[model samples]
Target chain A: MEPLLSCENVSFSYENTAVIKNLSFHVNSGDYLCIVGENGSGKSTLTKGLLGLKAPAEGKIIRGSDLHGNEIGYLPQQNPAQKDFPASVFEVVLSGRLNSRRFRPFYSKEDKKIARENLKKLGIEDLIKRSYRDLSGGQQQRVLLARALCAGSKLLFLDEPVTGLDPIVTEEMYKLILELNRKEKITIIMVSHDIKASVLYATHILHLNFDKSFFGRTEDYIKSPMGKYFFSE
Target chain B: MFNFAEMFQYSFMLRALIGGILISLCAALLGVSLVLKRYSMIGDGLSHVGFGALAIGSAANFSPLEFSIPIVILSAFFLLRISENSKIKGDAAIALISTSALAIGITAASLSGVNTDIDNYLFGSILSLSRSDLVICIIVFIVVMILFILFYNKIFAVTFDESFAKANGTRVGIYNMLIALLTALTIVIGMKLMGTLLISSLIIFPAIISMRICRRFKTVIIMSSIVSVVGFFAGLVISYNRSTPAGASVVLVNLAMLIVFYVIGTVSDKIKAKKFLKQ
Candidate 1:
């Protein structure tokens, strides 16, 4: 079967500084592909290109018209409070239900149901009533994760989703991600700075260096020069 | 002693009450979204821009609405365009547009000899307004309502995340422009009751006060409307009795309520923390 997402030779640059160069990757259905590179190695560019945030200067991305009707759910790195934003946790999470339907202004019963369920799944159900700006770093990360979950997407893309969380919370978040891909049958693509966590959770890995792009199963990549360089102690 | 029954019997006072309520509802609704998107200063900027536009309108013998929309639209178009680029920070961009528009407005009023009645623009005098002003208020209220309903999701989504909204099918530029245009138009109409200097207080004060108490987005809007309605009428009454500027009194009432809400928020936060600890 053809992959759910396929990018062909995607290249992008900002004014002449090439961020992504001749990059190509295909994300299979239910594949947990964790991408890693040194900072500014086009990891974010590829992620944005996948979501069509920045159009490629060179290639084509075929998401194939919403393969299952629900598309991508993305949780960017920035916290809602870091922006000093003024929305409650429930309000922010419910916003993720934007694509669910429109004729009504208020959140429907099903919308609340999905949000409550997602919060429960993420183990932060009690924080549903709290203000998003008032939460700590770890709690905010969980709330954001549940918000992304409320989108009811088949594929979830996270950009550095677990930065600043405590070690225990980080483990829980990564474990939750693994469960999302394995049991929920969702495709999870993320750019993680934690190489050890990437090795611990990712089913497959993509490594981009200044010259080459490498992609394979995680076990096979344990010895690749790019992988060793990234995961080196 | 002022007689309340006398003011109640007057047609002008009645229109002020009705127009004030409707306009309050419109501003309160849009204000919530504005606060969330971190574009609070746009309200102040557009209000000043409206003053300039109003000056031009009076000078050229045209309706303020007709003259104001184009100028505001032109400025809003540019502001929205520059926002996408990181060339200048957000507040700097807003400051640049706001100061320029304000300077031009002052210069236009001065040069045109258009009888720059500061009272009319600052504190809208009920005694001087004609039937046309009421009609304009009604039209503006309807326009705000229509815009709010027509692009509900698009507006909310844009406020939530600009990039994500663009990534989906929503046109961010059009929505941003629509918001700015409506804001500029609202400020122009708002100036009739509020005056140019104080109209932004009308947009933000209620939202800021209600935000301290409310947890829901829609609730904040509803609460803000209630706060605005109460403050506007109370100010009208006080201004009548005390002979103060109507615009300034209304703004003062809003500020007082904001302070009260601030105290309440602080006290409640402590009480909640105490209760949680005791548990």
Candidate 2:
């Protein structure tokens, strides 16, 4: 079977200066792929490209025949503005079903059921009525994760999900993501700066560097020179 | 002493009340999204554009409402485009457009030598709302209401997070344009009663005041609409009794409501904090 998503010689640039050049990678179903890179390594641009927010300057990104463009669940980095936003957990999660609603003005009963089920899946059912802004950071991330699950069940793209989180919460978050991949067989493409944790949790690793990039199984990546050098640093 | 029965006796007063209340409802509904999106001043900028359009229309011997409607709507789209794609930020873009429009309007009114009642346009004269204007106000109000109800969820999603909304294929641009279009319509109709200067208060105050106490978006929207309508009514009553300007008095009433809501929110927060400490 074809991989879930494949990028062929993809290049992205800002104002004629290339950030990601001739990058190629593929993500298969049930794969936990960690994209590790330093600052300004085009990780953000690549994330935008994969999410269909930005088109590659060269080459193409192909989704699986079964996966529609909007079917990819995306949990973007939390912006400061959203920290003080006024919305209930239920409302935030329910909004993730917007694509499923299509032409319908309001969410249907089935949509509401899916939202509740996702909340329950993430063990955040009790937070349904709570104000989203008032929740602790860990709880907020969980709520957002539940929201992402509501958007798409098969593929998830998380952008630095553990950023700003305490070490314990970060470990918990990583465990939760691992559980989703192992039990639910969900495909996860996580972009992170934490190469240590990324190597520990991810089944596959895509290390993006300014001049050189590597993509392979986690074991092979750990043996690769780039990975060894990164660990040494 | 204010005479409740006699206030409704005059036909012009009734027209003002009906038109003012309807515009207030529409403004408040759209204002919640605008305030949250940090586009609160778009109303003020668009109203200034409407003033310029009205001045040019009057000078050209055209129907002010018909001519200004399309122009103001176009400016709304232009404002959105430049703000998104250009280097100019949102507030700066609004300021640029509004000041230019105001300057052009003032120059055009003076150059035409039509002896227009510019003060009425600047400060608003509620009693000057003609029957035809009132009819237009009613139609716009209905359209705004229906569209708002139909797209409420999409609007909420867009306001809360534009990137997430777009990622889910929510067509964030279209919803944003829809908001801009509705705000333009509301500002134009409201400018006749609230004036170019004070019209944005109708769009800003209600949303901000309701947000003081409402923790949820739905409640914020509902409370905003209620506050706007009640404040408009009370302002009309006070203006009628004291013989004050309708626009200024309505804004004053909204300000008073804001203070009241602020106090209530603070008190409730203190009570909740105390209970938490006790526990």
Candidate 3:
């Protein structure tokens, strides 16, 4: 089967300044690909490229025809601007279905069912009528994850999803992501600042830095020199 | 003491009430998204642009809405683009455009010597709404209402998170332009009732007031509509009774409603906190 996503020699930039240079990767169906990098390491930019929010300066990004734009789910990092965002959990999740339908004034019953199902999957079904901002950080992440699931179950891209989460919540979020990958067989591309956590959950690892990077199976990544340096000390 | 039935008998008063209600409803509906997106000031800026366009139209002896609607829409699009592409962002860009348009409008009004009409545009004279203005107000209201309903979810998505909406294949730019155009038209029509100086209150005060008491997007929108219509109606009545400026009275009514809602929100929070503590 063709890969779900493939980026061949892709270079990305902002304002003519290159952030990602000649990066290449492919994601098969059900693959849990974790992108590990330091701050400002182009992880978010790479995902933005794949999402078509930003066009690559060089090379090609191939998303399967069935998996373009609104067909791919995304969970961006938390921000203060959305702190007081006035939305019910139901409304937030239902918006994810906007990409699936065309020219409809409101959501269909099928969309509502899908939203409800995703909320249940994330164990947030009870929050459907609750205010999104009233929830705790973990609940908000779950709500967002449910929304992403509503967009597309075939692929998910999460950018530092647990950045501001507590350790226990982080572990739970990772478990939830793992469940989606393992049980639902969803493809995941997660940008993570925690190398150890990436090694723990990822089947494939793509390490990015200013100058050089590594891309391979998690086992090989663990034994690699840079990985040795990271894991040993 | 005001006689509501007697006030309704006057044709001008009827026009003012109808036009004011329609304008308020439209502005309130669109206000939720604008407030959420931090583009509330865009309404203020675009209204200033409308003032300039109106001045030119009055001086040129043309229909003001014809000139102002398109011009304000263009300026709104320009503001959106500048904020997106240029280093000068949100509030700063609005202030720059707003002051420039205000200055140009005032200067043009002075040169043209159309002082009375300009004053009507500046501070509003609801009692002076022409039949044509009423007709235009109704048509604009219908268009805005229909477009807002059809694209409600899309607008909600865009307002909540533009990047996420884009990633999800919603054309962020097109929807943004749609919002700008709708808001611009609403502002143009609304300037007649609230004037250029105070019209943004029509687009802003309701959202803030509703947000005080409502937590959900749809609830906030619904509440805002109620607040805006009621406030506009009450303000019209007050202005008619006291012979005050319709625009200023409407703004004051809205401000009063905001205070009421703020108190309600505070009280509710206190009660909830007490309940939680008892538990």
Candidate 4:
């Protein structure tokens, strides 16, 4: 089968200053690819680049015919600005369907059904009427996940999904992601700073060590020099 | 000393009532996104730009609305671009542009001996809303209302998360420009009722007040419209009855509602906290 996404020597930059250089990888359907890197290593930028939020400063990115950016759900990092957003969980999730129904004045019933299905899947259906800002952190993340699910069909990209969560919540989130990849067979490309967790759950690993990057299947990555170094550390 | 029903007898009062309510609703609708995005002060900046355009239009013997509309729209677009591009950001950019525009307007008004007109524009006499002004307000208000409703979902998406919306194929730039243009038009129309310095209160007060009580976005929007309309009517009535200034009276009513809602929000929040702690 053709790869869902392929990058050929992609370089990302800000203000003409290159931050990521000559990165190449392919994400196949049903692959759980976890990208690990240090702070400011362009891990999040790579996700943005793949979603066409930012154009590559160099080289090309080829997406499969059915895999447009709009069809890829994305869960961005949490920020203070969205904390006070006066929206219900239902409205927030419903907005994720905006891309599907273009030029329509309001959300259709089908869109609401999708939103409700995602909320039920995330086990937050009961909280649908509650305000988004009033929810706890874990609850908010689940609502956001439901929103992202409403946006995409098969591909989901999460940027540091477990960041700022307690250890128990982090573990739960990882388990939830594992269930999505294993049971639902959704294609997952996740960016994470937690190297150990990424190695454990990912089918493939893309490690950006700044000086040298490594990308390979999980089994092969375990025996690689950089992998050995990370293990030893 | 004036009766509320008798005030409607005058044609100018009728014009003021209709024009004020329409402009209030438009301002309230746009205010939600602006307040959310922390760009609430853009209204003030654009109104100052309108004042400057008014002074220039007076000097050039052009209709103030025709002259100021384009200039204010242009300035709104510029503010959007500058806030995004430059390091100055939103509020500072607004301060910079508005102060300069105010200075230019004052100078132009002094030079052209239109300072008295400037005062009328600044303080905003409700009786000054002409028949042509009423007609223009109605047309502009209808266009803005229709466009706002049609693009409601798109605007919500953009306001909630712009980058995410862009990734989902929404043209964030174009929508931002559309919002700016609509806001500029509303500010210009509202100027005849609210004035330059006080006009932003019409845009800001409703949304913030609604947020204090309404938790859901749609509810907040609906409540904001209701608050704005009611406040305008109440302010007009009180001003007419007591012989006070229209713009200031309206803003004071909004202010009073905001405080009332804030107190209610705080008390309810305390109750919620107590319940959660007990659980």
Candidate 5:
């Protein structure tokens, strides 16, 4: 079967300066791909390109025939505006079904069922009626994860899911993500700065560097020169 | 002494009451989204542009409402476009556009020599509402309410998170423009009742005040609508009895409600905190 997502010699630029250059990779179905890079390695720009938020200045990105554009779930980094936003957990999660509803004004019965199931999956069913802003950081992340699941069951893009979380909460979050990838069989493309956790959980690792990039299985990546240096560091 | 039965005796008073309540309801409905999106001042900015458009329309011998609607709508779109792509930023762009429009409106009104009472436009006179104006107000109110109901979910999504909405193929640009368009219509029609200086209060105050006590988006919107209608009606009554400017009275009523809700919100928050500690 063809890969779920493939990018061929993709490049992105901002204000005439190239941020991501000649990047090429493919993600297979049911694969957990961790994109590990340092600050300003164009991780965000690459994610934007893959998500179709920005057009690649060069090359092309192809999505598999079975995958629709709106079926990709995305959990963006938390912004300040949402910190004080007044919304119930149900309303925020229900909004994830906006794509499926299309021109329809309201969510259908099936949409509501899915939202509720996702909330249960994330162990946040009790928070359905709670105010979103009042939740702790860990609880908030779970709510957002459930929301992303409602949007797309096949693929998920999580940007630094454990940032700003305590060590215990971060471990729990990682375990939850691992369960989704291994048991639920969901494809995940997570961007992270934590190389250790990425190596521990990801099936495939894509190490982005300005001069040279590496992409391969987790075992091969462990032995690779760039991986050895970063892993040891 | 204010007579409760005597206030509704005048035909102009009834017209003002109907027009004011409809505009207030529409403004409050759109206000929740606008305030959440941090575009609350868009109403104020667009009303200034409407005032300018009305000045030009009168000078050119055209129906002010017909001519101002399209002009103000175009300005609304322009404001959205520039704020998105330009370096001026949202608040600065609004200030630039609104001030320039106000200056142009004042100049046009002075040069045309058309016996136009500029103060009527500046402060709003409820007694000036005519039967024809009330008819247009009713039509615009229906259109605003229908569109809002049809796109309520989408608006909430866009306001809460533009990037997430766009990623899921929600067409954020179109919804943003839709909001600007509806607000332009509301501001132009409301300008006659609330004046350019005070119309935005009708769009902003009720939303913020209701948010003090309402925790959910639906409840916030519902509460704001109720607050707006009641506040506008009370303001109209006070203005009728005291012979005060309708627009100022309406704003003061809203401001007073804001304080009342603020106290209520604070006290309830303390009570919740105490209960949590006990648990």
Candidate 6:
């Protein structure tokens, strides 16, 4: 199958220091690939480059064979701005519906209907009118995920998606991701710091160790000596 | 050249004064989102762009508002697009567009030999506004007020988070572009009374003051409008007393309010801390 996204020898630097070097990888349709690394290991930087939020100083990112903005949705780690912004949840979700078509002509009531359906699907339709800033971390994460889903995206990108959740909620979050992947055949690429927990949910793993990488099936990696060295289990 | 009393006595000055009040109301209303989103620079930058466009419009024998309106809108749109890509910091992009437009405008005015009227654009002439300018200002002010009332939810949503907005299917780009267009309109119409250099003060100063004093979003907006209108009245009175420019005096009055609010917020915090120790 044609890969959705391919990065060949992708590299980036900040002033004199290199953050990512000669990093090359690919993601395919219906693949839930979780990237694991320590802080400053370039996980977030890699995702940012993929989303076109940042420009890599060197290397190339070939997209749409795997995913594009229209086909890819992202849930950023921190929405520090959303705290002071006074917008309702309903309005927040509607913004995801953008990039569908320009000039709209007349908004299909159908799209609005789908947005509502997505909110309900995330089990937070009751919080639809509340200020986005008021929600708890878990709820906000769910809301943001729903918003990402509203884009009709076939692939989802989540960065540190379970950072502040309780164990049960984290379990539920993983369950939800699995459900989406299983039911909708949607591809998910996530940058997760939780090495052990994420292993349960991820189908494939892209393990980055500064200048080198281990890319293959997650189960195989768990049995590999490198995984034991890194995860120590 | 209208005389001071003649300017005061004529219905036109009265209309301009009232027009300034209305336009300033729109500025204060929009300022909440602008300040909170840290896009007060968007207003400031676009207003400067409008100033340049206004100068060229007058020098080239075209309608200043006509030339200014589109260019201001385009700059606002560009700012929004740049913001989404996040290639450069939003503040940096705002500064780049803001200064470039101002430079272009200065060059255009110099080349056209219209330096004499530049002061009117930079430091608005309250005594000489035309009847048509007054009417258009009022119309633009009303249109701005109505759009805010109608689209407050969508505007609030996108300003808070563009991606979250896009994910929810709210036409994030269109709404963002629309906001830029609205901001450009406010700046263009407002330039007639407040001038380019000082008008953004009407949006930002009120917000800075309100955010310092008010706790809730509703309270913040109300306080901003109140602070602004009061500054207008106080400035007009001082301008009359000092025989100075009304627009410039108004800006000084805004600066004064900022100082007062900063002191009050600081003192209040000190008082609360002292009470906590006593308890």
Report every candidate's CA lDDT. 0.77, 0.91, 0.89, 0.88, 0.89, 0.77
lDDT of 6 by residue, B116-206 (tens): 6688788876764678877777788778877876666566656666654554345666766767777778778878778888888888888
DockQ of 5: 0.85
Instruction: Please identify which of the two predictions, 2 or 3, would achieve the higher lDDT against the true structure.
Output: 2
lDDT by residue for model 2 (B1-279), tens: 668789999999999999999999999999999888878777889999999888877877788889999999999898887767747687887898899999988888899895445677888987779999999999999999999999999999899888888888888999999999999999998998999899999999999999899989999999999999999999999999999999999999999999999999999999999998999
lDDT of 4 by residue, B136-205 (tens): 8898899888988999888888888886787788899998999999999999989988888899999999
Q: TM-score of each candidate? A: 0.92, 0.96, 0.96, 0.96, 0.95, 0.66
In angstroms, give how far residue B101 of model 4 lies from its true place.
Answer: 0.4
Candidate 1's residue-wise lDDT over B195-251, tens digit each? 877888878888889989886666776799899889898888888878887788888
Classify candidate 6 by CAPRI docking class. Answer: incorrect
Cα DockQ of the candidate 4 complex: 0.79
Tell me the spans in candidate 4 whose CA falls farther than 4 Å from its real position.
A209-211, B277-279
Predicted structure with the largest DockQ when compared to the true one: 5
Better of 3 and 6 by TM-score: 3
Off by over 4 Å in 3: A65-69
**Span of 10 residues, lowest total lDDT, candidate 4 chain B:** B82-91
**Residue B142, model 4, lDDT:** 95
| TM-score between candidate 4 and the true structure | 0.96
lDDT by residue (tens digit), candidate 3, A115-143: 99999998888999988878899999999
Those runs of model 5 whose alpha carbons end farther than 4 Å from true positions after fitting are B114-116
What is residue A183's positional error in candidate 3, in angstroms?
2.2
Candidate 1 wrongly placed segments (more than 4 Å): A64-70, A79-88, A102-108, B114-119, B122-124, B149-154
Collision pairs in model 5:
none
